[model samples]
Target: MTKLQSGMSRRYFLQVTGSGLVTATALGGSALQARAEPYDTFTWISPRGTLEVLDDYPYWSALKMGYFGDLKTEMQPGPSDGTATVKFVDVGQADMGFPSPGVFSFAIENGMNLKSVFHMGARDTFSIAFRKGEGTRDLKQLEGKTILLGSAAWQSIVDPMLAAQGVDITKVNYVEAGWPTWATALAAGQGDAALSWEGLRAEWIANGLEFEYWLGVQHSTLPANTFVVRSADLEDPDRKAFLEKYLRGWAMGLEFGYLNPRAAVEAVYEQFPTFASNTGPELGTTSILQQINVFRGDMENREGWGWHDMSSWQAFFDQIHAIGQITKPVKAEDVCTNELIAAANDFDHEKVKADAEAYQLSEEFAAIDVENIQAHMFDNAV
Candidate 1:
């Protein structure tokens, strides 16, 4: 198979398993009639700043498409830090928020009652990018070399990737770095390597940097970015409705994005016009379509579009516990619930698959080439 074809096959296999599809009842009249109460409005918090693409894009699409019209959602923006977002949810300032699974693992270790409802990206898109001539084919080569990282959570990710390759992190020199300053720090020769996401990889490559990636190894332990809610909120009927409706709308929005790349690109650009100037229209458009394709292509045919697997969850928690990231063993039951995702199963799965496949073959998918594919797939923008 050609590289593109191989990529498509990989995409299909990942979606089939990653999307978490389980055979279940549809949200037919019987399911809807079973609800005993009326829906109420709820507030969701997303990270603030222009980088809202990861957290706010789906919500924005849902709102634009009237996905949450029935539940009446009010979105509030919070700081980008996942830990801060968790605090906002804990204090009841927000009913729901976006946090990386690493943050969730940290909170659960500390005995926080957090639960993740949706999986934002199918795979870990963050990586450690190194200069090409550095002889750094693997993490082991970094032994005794200084590496830059943004947060402790990043260590959780890097630790395992290195461990698997038989490299001990204790042997490496670690530097605490700020997210915004990481790219420049590496380019200026201040750090041997930088922990980065796909977007940063694209930016670096565009600027003439030669680098190889160490894609987010977090998925080997935990889900990447997930929509999390406090455990107390799961029983609320409105909260349930909000999640169900939101997922449905999100699935649709993803499909819409896949089917209409130019339109989706315009929508994303409209929301974050600064990208046009910084990355230019061509690269910006490429970045957005890559994300849309990866998300839709990998998740379209799965049983749960954004639900976590029980085995995967348990394995992740086990790893987190071993690393001292959590004080106690975290259970799958404690961190995530399938109630809402199970409810979404009532919608048409075959139709969802068909739409997603059509999207994979659309012009938007075709517009992306392999080298740029990795970059766009993880673009932080919508």
Candidate 2:
């Protein structure tokens, strides 16, 4: 088996990796000591294509900032969807993966003993996007309308969202299509509405389309994405302690992103020049800021960052169970654990938040409001 070599830079984390990834020394079990552990190698797989994008700001930032301590992290960009990510983690092809709850649940039923350690996007980003003036305003509006879907897994979200609005699923027509252009199609009256994740919000602006969308979080009790590994890993005290330190740095990167979104975007653009896309800084920074809002959702109020009560995951499991995706009631307790994340937040969060909040931006950056996350979410969204 190939191992991730040392001296690997953060910018190229996703580019190269041998067969095997990481093996680190352990730390104390109970107390979260602010000590870094050294690891020969480890593999981390990204759910998305590259770290240059907005959602992955934390990972890229952490790498550049040396958050992994001495771990030789071999990062790989995942293929197509979370399914590949789940499989990679299941078979040991990857040491860890960031998978959605749906994918994570599926793996559990398939006999993969996985556990979630981090919650990346607490609020659900999945939605049905429509134009501002004529686009869909609510989930109830989807009745008798043609909606474009991304994949079969989306039904887990589509069915429940419609049901929550008291709309019958049979009344809606679902058509599968590729994204980034669905907004244009909806604008041209090709469909009544289109399914969207917040990530696609940038594409809407890229195409100069006015849009507002519905969030799955507002309508359901489910989270968006999380970092996961084998359930067995938690059995090892050293491994678990190492995760806590890693999360500490990861959280720092996320907070830093909020403090200086423009700098974060610029850093990624400078590193992965191909991701620049020539969209210019104003729009890119705005997109990155929009994503930052989602990352901070209810984190302060919840059981710290990445921590969640089982009740929060119930509705999602119930919805998927009805659609035959989950055969029986998948107990949230059996599927996920907040032990590591709870420890990850043991550090002084107030300092991180204050630092980010205090970061002053240049006029060019200040002029662009990060709060205007949805150009179409509200008439006065900004």
Candidate 3:
């Protein structure tokens, strides 16, 4: 057998060997199928706008390659509103939803019954942006200055970081500026600084807006993006199997993207035709890949792809609980299971490693211009 097939066989052997005792005890006379039947359709929701970049081009590649066919996913892209996504999943309007980790954690703590299954991007994508060559070298300089912020959760991350540098948030005037108004507000001198993600920073810098990034001061340990399914759905054997298969496909997609970024970009362009006109397909794809790489940089070598360990989850949960974002603490079991991810790791270690290496070597890893599609769309609408 080939190395890949041999690996698969080994994993199957392990699964069969490990579960043999449990199967004998759990089912004395009943027959258990070796493989579950695939679902007909699985609907998924994602935030609207450029944030859809989280969906990643390799996902499209995987879909085109029939990676998710085993689960029979229909793959629907929904609006970007977190509240709406949560509501849809809770009411059965949607089978799954992707929301920022902060939003999902808050929802779960409040008894939303939303269980996070997979972490899409693994790092804190948010950052503070200031004009280059300004006195905004560190978090300390922001004291007594007006800063534009989105909302409470946004400030939660910033406040702690600032306080660590002897700067109290109360000392700084925090204006309520939505994300749509951030770039303009900062450029128009409405605030001394703005809180944004690296994608936004990339767009602003590309547009000739030079800014200094405070990489040292991060506000939250929460996973920036994640996939969640309703509690009821988890009880269904077919649905559960589908979820496992979907995650396997997703890991494959991510691995493919890491392996061949250019091909993945082409795949995304073909799937999302609108991407062609939005910001130049090449640029958009490059931007998406770059952001993924940035997040992977933290735990690339050790953790493997899309692997969220118990310790990392607990650390992030504790941060949320401490900030009042989550009313009650959630145990790691409440969120995700590493069993399937571990299975994926075992299924194709060499492919995973090769993909990781390719991502580390890609040219897009250096830099890519991100367009402020939010701003551009608003401008065109007006």
Candidate 4:
């Protein structure tokens, strides 16, 4: 993958630590305190600047439902740098990190000894959004059009997705319109389209930047995001057990969202009132339901949530490498595993579903017509 010119890099990570840009005390000093001792708090870092986004409904749901009973947890919103989440986990600053498959692969290529423990997004969540009535029914029509991106680093993400659809990526132009504003730029006619994903689609509408979309969840065959941790931790029994427990909480949380998307949105809203006030209950629920669809793709054929389809992952790796996004070859088994999947799924399904059905909602959340929202969830999807 191409390194970000203004973002984090392997050399930058090493140089920063070596030059004291990051204080030793803040980075666990010399002992890496986060991993050296068995701690009560399990920290999961986000790949973005804030955790207020609706994409993390599962974690917020788990937090609200007390699914992680007695297991102290912390949700740390890392920097907006694309590589910060994996870097934090690599240096023991955080216990786990949620990274896109592209970012995870980049970390591995840079020699970070990390393993994806839980495959959270079973399907690709990336998408391309065009001004309403301006998108083509076929991706090939985008060959000569420009696509807006939050950062140049995202080109690596868009390349393979376009290639998968047989689009001539060489003919496509990408413009880095900057983060937190790419959607607005698209609305202002700054570009022909902007990169987007499941949860963000609803949030964009709430922001009044509605656009027609070619959703990756419906088009791309690549693997999506996953939860990764230090590989060595998996060998230790205590850490391994804790990892399973953490993943189980998320799995149950996903189940909860599937059963009651409104309740899931209510949980997220309780955790992030500012975000709730901005998007309202209807759009918040819409976002949660959108991700629910990605998180649990082809449920009938899958063993459970967090199950990795190694074949599909392998194909994704092959496609990226073929497109020259990855310089070195990557094997699916080396980057991810399904060992924790069975243990993570060993939970009381009936109880989780019951909890979802019984979850109390705020007046606004209670008034949301989730069925109607779901029924038109893909209205803008091309």
Say which candidate scores most in TM-score: 4
Clashes of each: 8, 5, 2, 0
lDDT of 3 at 237: 78
- Name the regions of candidate 1 deviating beyond 4 angstroms: 1-41, 47-56, 74-77, 80-82, 203-210, 217-222, 289-301, 345-382
Clashing pairs in 2: 21-41, 21-42, 22-41, 22-42, 211-376
lDDT of 4 by residue, 35-99 (tens): 34564678898876679997788888887888888888888886666677787777676779888
lDDT (Cα atoms) of all candidates against the true structure: 0.55, 0.63, 0.55, 0.81
TM-score preference between candidates 1 and 2, better one = 2
Q: What TM-score, to 2 decimals, does candidate 1 have? A: 0.73
Q: Kindly list the per-residue Cα lDDT of model 3 for residues 268-317, writing each as its tens digit.
A: 66665664445454455545555555445466444555666566677667
User: Model 1, range 25-126, lDDT digits (tens) per residue?
Assistant: 212111111122333446676532235343344555546655455666676655434355555555444567666666667556544567888766555555
Worst 10 residues of 1 by lDDT: 1-10
- Between prediction 1 and prediction 3, the one with superior TM-score is 1
Q: Ten-residue segment with the worst summed lDDT in candidate 4?
A: 24-33
What's every prediction's RMSD, in angstroms? Answer: 13.4, 8.3, 13.3, 5.2
Among these predictions, the greatest lDDT belongs to 4
